[model samples]
Structures are given as C-alpha cells and as structure tokens.
Target: SSLGHHDIIEYLLNHDADPTITSIKNLTPYDLAKDKETRNVFRRYMAEHMDKWNWSNAHVPIEKSESTSSASKKNGSSISGKSLDSSSSLIGLPAEMRTRIERERRARAAEVRLNAMQNRGTPKPLTLPSIGNVICNVCEKSLVGLVPFEICELKFCSTVCVKNYRDREST
Candidate 1:
C-alpha cells in the first residue's frame, strides 16, 4: 500500500481487502502502492483468486506484475518467496556470484517473513531497505524502482558492474 507495510497489506488482502474500493482521490489499492513489491502483493492475490473479487472493476493498471497468470500456489499465503523471475536484479553476475546474491536476498526476505509471523499478536510497522536514492558505483545511474543489486559492502547499478568489480579485484 501507500505505507509499504508489506505484512499488514498482505494480511488485509488475504482477509478479503477490496482493492477495487477507491479512495476519495479515486485511487485503488494498486494505485496507492508505494513500490513494486507492494503492488506484487495485490497482483498475487488477484491471480490466485480470480473469481473471488471483481478485478476488472478494481482499476489495476496493466503490466504492473507477472502474477496475472494462474500462478496460484493452492492456498499459499506468500508465493513470492518460492522463486525469482528471469529478470532478477542479479542478472549481471556470473552464475556462482548470482547464486550467492540470490541466497542473500532470500535470507533477508525469510528474516522479514519470520518477523512478521512472530508479531501476530499486533500489527507492527516494518521498514524495508532505502537503497532507492543511492546511485550505482560504476554507471552512476539512479537505482530508483530498480533492484538493490549488491555484493559485500559495495552496491552497483547492475550485475555487470558487480562482475566488473570482482574482475578488477582479482586483476
């Protein structure tokens, strides 16, 4: 949602939060989503429960996610943790390096999920990484709306940079 509280947002969606319900400003939940991941939550739900909600009336913008297909996990609460898309942020790294980066990413996500599961007594606010404003070390391009492609203490704009950095380190 607008607040980017993934846990609360997912809970509401799972519990039948109506994305079609618009605000006074005429913004639906998808419209108010602060980032890609938040929108993914809505996309995942609409994909799994196609008949449960009137999606066409929800005003979801087209191409917001790849979850439009029937990628339903059969009553799964979080489908994202299971796999990464082909266009993952770590695309530029070598196979071994990509594997390492993905493991790190998955570990971070798993930690967040565990925290959310444990805090079921009350809805607690969660904060995600703020790597959007940082520029890539190699290309100097802004990383906004892009993945926080990283390795060790270094962050890069792309996997190629990560590979280039590693190569530079060796030679």
Candidate 2:
C-alpha cells in the first residue's frame, strides 16, 4: 500500500498491522517511506519491534468457506482440491516478484522465437546487386550485400565508410 501518512503508519504499528507487509512492488512501508521523517519513524519502529515480528505468520492460509465450496460444486468445476482464487493466490506475492516473473516468461518466449528463426537459416541481407560495379569509396570493395551510400553521387559501402572518407578529406 502507498504509505503517505507517518501518523497512520505509527498508529497501525501500535495496533497489530504488519509493517513488513509489501505492496505489488515488493515494497514495504519502510521501502515506500519517502521523507526523512517517515524513514526515521519506520527505522525506529523496526529497531524496537523487528525481533517480535513473526515471519512465518506473514502468509495466512485462506480457508475455503462452505458457501464458496457449495457454489463451486454448483458451477460444475471438475478441477479437484481448493478452487484457485486469482486475487487470493497473489495476496502474498509482492508486485515486484509478479513483474519479474512476467518479464522472465516473455524473455523465455522471445529466446525460443529467436532460436527458431536461427534454425531456419540466416536471412538474406539487402544489397544493391542491381546497381553493379559499385565499389566502396573507403574500403575499395564491391558493394554486394552491403548497401551503397551516395554523398554527392560518390558511392560508399556504408554510412561509417562515408564518415571516414569525409573525415579524411577534412583533414
């Protein structure tokens, strides 16, 4: 949750609210503390009560109510075991963890696609083959697959070659 008020945080801490509870970004109240005052408040609270905080109790098991179980049966969901509640399943996960998981999944998919493309063989490079007999001004090589650049009708192999030629002329 976005922590804006130090007094409210302190009040919550004084009661029984878990200070270690993280938001979707995996940021706790301490992490979200923006101002020096808020940070100091969190720091002080942590210093005093850090040992008392029960790490195991952080994840409270969600007990399926009778009504929910009966409703699931009526809906004819053949899936066995406790019904998965999307929101409840994510209740313990920090937002940062979720984002990281999603990013990793996308990266893996991209890697698979890249591997598939690679296995299909290298794509043909664009060339000015039709132009014929055009040589790179700098390298003095045939511009086969390499694109030719024209600076005042003087052909070069690439922009880099053109820049190099220009630099040489300027010197």
Candidate 3:
C-alpha cells in the first residue's frame, strides 16, 4: 500500500505478499511503482528467487539490467511511454524537496512495517515461526507431532509451556 516506497515494497515481497494482486482498477504492483528504482526492486527480487513465485504474475517489467535507472530517466518509463510521470524526474527537484521526499519515504516505510507486524497477530501453530522452528504459541518451541496437545486452540511444545501460559494468564 506504501506506493513509491521501495523498502516497504521489498519488505512486503520478502514476507510473501502477492505482488500481482490488483486493485479495483486492475492496477498491479508494477503498475503502481512510483519510480524505476522501485520497479527494479521487484525485478531484482524475482531474479534472486526464481522458483519461489510465478514472476510473470508479478506484473513487473522484465527488463533486467543495471542500466535501467538511466534508461528510465531517458525514456521516462520502461513501458515505452505508456506510463505517466514517475519519481525519476525528482532528480531535478531542489534539495529541500528531495529531503522532504526522503522523510516521507521513511515515514511510509515505518507505517508499513508497523502494519505488517500488527497484522501477523498470534503465531499459528505448525506455520513456521519468525526465527527458529517454533510451532508452540507459548514457549515457541518446535513441537513433536507424535502426540497432540492443545488448550483453547493454542498448541504447545511441552507441558511446561502450557503451565507457563496458564501461570502468566492467571497473574
């Protein structure tokens, strides 16, 4: 949602958010890219992780090159003038304007990161944890599936974690 913000876009992509998803207007993430660099971030990601996703569905341009920055500046867009004004022209703006844009980018990135973290909510058991292999909601330890142990829909790796969860809730 943080359009024009490369870091935020990268973060969302890294977290497995679908990039090819379209808005009501049928605009894709590539369609919403605010600058050549931002578009390149998507391209680079697709290049780095080839088998991870169907990049054709990503809708980003396939022009993979280091000279894309200069090319976009010269041509205004990779889509052969189909796209409108991009932030690539921002290079000609005054220093203060560039600084303001930078501030806005950072603010937007922070807002996106916060939203992403908040949306994750509680850990879903069996779904990979953020760090190590954790399937337990309490201790966050990887559970042995030989036996099922659950309380109120929460899974635990051990009885100790269950006890700890109950003890904390009672306090």
Question: What is model 2's C-alpha RMSD?
Answer: 19.6
Better of 1 and 3 by TM-score: 3
Candidate 1 structure quality by residue, lDDT tens digits, 1-171: 899987788899888887889874345788688988888777777777877877645644222234522353333533564433533334455887566555655655655584565356432222234542665544445666778577664467678867766776677
Predicted structure 3: lDDT: 0.64
Expressed as tens digits, the lDDT of each residue in 59-83 for candidate 3 is 5533334564576657657566333
Q: Worst ten-residue run, lDDT, model 3? A: 81-90
State the TM-score for model 2: 0.30
What is the TM-score of each predicted model, taking all chains together? 0.36, 0.30, 0.37
Provide the overall lDDT of each model, using Cα atoms, as 2-decimal numbers: 0.61, 0.57, 0.64
lDDT of 1 at 74: 35
Question: Cα miss at 1, model 3 (Å)?
Answer: 5.8
Give the clashing pairs for model 1. none
Please, what are the lDDT tens digits per residue for candidate 2 over residues 1-171? 244687887788789888668664344666567675665565556556756674222321223455765776787653654444534333456897555544644554654564464347432222334564666655555776766787766677777777877887787
Quickly count the clashes in candidate 3: 0
